[model samples]
Target: MKILFFDTKTYDKESFNKQLEHYPEIEIEYLKADLAPRTAPLAKGYDAVCGFVSSDVGSETMDALREAGIKLILMRCAGYNNVDLEKAEEYGIKVMRVPGYSPEAVAEHAMALALTANRRIHKAYVKVRENDFSLSGLMGFNFYEKTAGIVGTGKIGAAMAKICRGFGMKVIAYDVHRNPELDFAEYVSLDELLSRSDLISLHCPLMDSTYHLINRDTIAKMKDGVILVNTSRGGLVKTADLIEGIRARKFFGVGLDVYEEETNNVFEDRSDEILEHSTTARLLSFPNVMITSHQGFFTQEALAAISGTTLDNAVAFQKGIQNGNEVSA
Candidate 1:
């Protein structure tokens, strides 16, 4: 089977290429452009189209892909918020995703962000680079005996909770469906978690109820000087509200691997160009705020799992065997 991959990065090509050796029957063509209405026609002769989190798989793009005889939409990442599931269903295009690819990779990255920001490790690295390490303004509280609020209790969230527990922290979580396996954490209301947690980490998906979950009012509900970390979907937190919260000094530190408006900015080089988004620009000006380019799932283990699962999904679909990874509206 022939597959067309969009938004091809160097790392993506490397990982996929390494895995492609195992699937000799599958041939793939890579493109740097993102999948959208304008580029959907490029998959005219391909059996499937592989996309990432940044790809625009909306109705128009799905329509174009369907017209081009594309039967499968294989997402290489866990999040499918960018995909129009209803359109895929209407077009008879099967959508498959790597649902859980190394939850530990993302969970560890979330902890890295929280620890890095909380201890001001980045600042200390800069100071030491200039041979000036006085340790002033680098005071960080111990994670032990602190309250950690996990917003979701899925595999990733559960992993994060375990990590926090390892730090001797009290773990509290807020999720619609509580996981009984996560007995280490006590399930509580969102408001209760917000008011009680010294460190709040978001691990939820982006949905109608979760969009802008951390907004103005929600930020107000959080404890003052709380450390906030987000390694989940970008839209889960409002960038404008987060900036406002930083201005008000409501957060002791903010570590973000994703942001609401990071579509074109993330995974792209814009160092030579001026930032168009004022909120993102203002966020960079703050000392306590650290932003990464949505790289929580960039680890080797996660990439390998994603490539393997994505290929397996494609093979399963081609064989008309429903492996239960197919998604619908």
Candidate 2:
């Protein structure tokens, strides 16, 4: 079967090409343009379209794809907040995603962010490069015996909790459905977790209830100078509120792998151009804030799992076999 891939980069091509050897029957065409209404017609003859987190798979795009005879929407990443699930259902387009592609990869990245931000390693590296080795601004606290609040308790969050435990930090988690397997973390109320945690890491999905979960009022609930890390969906935190919080010196440091308006700039290199997004520009002005392009799941193990599962999901759809990866509105 033929499939069209959207917003593909060099790494995506490399990983998918390597995994394509295992599935000789499938042929994939890569496109740099993201999947939006204007580009949906490009999949006219393909049986499926593969998209990344940045792709716009709204109702209009889904309608265009349906008219173009596209039957499947295969998401290479875990998050599907960008896709209009109800519209895909109406258009008879089956949606599937790689839900748990190397949870350890993302969990480890979250820890790395927290560690880097807490110890101010980025600043130290810059200072050392210039032969200014004074440790005056590099003062940092020990992770041992600190309270770590985890906002989600899925596979990724559970893995993060384990890492925090290894550092001798007390881990607490807040989730609608608690994972009994996360014995290292104690489940608590959202308010309790926010008010008590010294380090707060977000690992939740973006949904209506979770949109801007860390807003102005929620930030007010957090401990003063709390270290915050987000390796999850960008919409989970309101960028404006975060900016205000930073101005108030409410956070010790912030590490972000995703942002609410990252789709326009994340994968592309626009260093020569001026940044149009005011919030992102303001965020970059802060020395304590560290932002990375959405790359939490960019490891080799994660890419292999994503490509393998995405191909398996496509094969299942072609054979009319239902599996756990299938998503509906």
Q: 42-153, model 1: which lDDT tens digit per residue?
A: 9999999999899999989988999999999999988888999998988889999998999999999999999988999988998999999799978888999999999998
State the C-alpha lDDT per candidate. 0.92, 0.92
Candidate 2 weakest ten by summed lDDT: 275-284
**Location of the lowest summed lDDT over 10 successive residues in candidate 1:** 275-284
Residue pairs clashing in model 2 are none
Segments in model 1 whose C-alpha atoms lie over 4 Å from true places: none
What TM-score, over all chains together, does every model reach?
0.98, 0.98
